[model samples]
Target: MPIGRADVSPPHWRKSSYSNGSGGACIEVADNLPHTIPVRDSKNPTRTPLLFTPDAWASFVTAVAIGRLAD
Candidate 1:
């Protein structure tokens, strides 16, 4: 079941590992979707989520893991 924008009405969002318990900068990702990875700000879940292809999301995760996206 490929996920479309309209199909993401109720996503099961999970917080990023980088997120802290003190309500700091937090991002939530919904990978349960079939084809798309949905990302949203934990602080503002009602806002529209950003969608990414599974491959693109995997690449972004790899980059972040390898410090290629470090500040």
Candidate 2:
């Protein structure tokens, strides 16, 4: 199923730990939401967020953890 604009709530967000300290490559994630992962640009918090299924997010994290996404 495709995610629609109404599927996610407005949220308070935080930047990913992998983001550069200077804010380049900043990635923002919302907390306290169930069943979905909402991510946006830390530099543009007001923009529309990209939504991920929780399982997809988990797999992405696992890949990063195992060095699959590293340069």
For TM-score, the strongest prediction is: 1
lDDT score of residue 53 within candidate 2: 79
lDDT of 1 by residue, 1-71 (tens): 43444454567889999889999889999988767799999999999999998899999999999999999
Clashing pairs in 2: none
Relative to the true structure, how large is the alpha-carbon lDDT of every model? 0.87, 0.83
Write model 2 residue lDDT over 1-71, tens digit each, in one string.
45554446666688899999986899999765777788999899888899897889889999999999999
Model 1 TM-score (2 dp): 0.83
Q: Backbone clashes in each candidate structure, one number apiece?
A: 0, 0
True-structure Cα RMSD, model 1: 2.9
Least lDDT summed over 10 consecutive residues: which range in candidate 2? 1-10
Best-matching candidate per lDDT: 1
Please provide TM-scores, in order, for all candidate models, with all chains considered together.
0.83, 0.79
lDDT of 1: 0.87
Off by over 4 Å in 1: 1-9
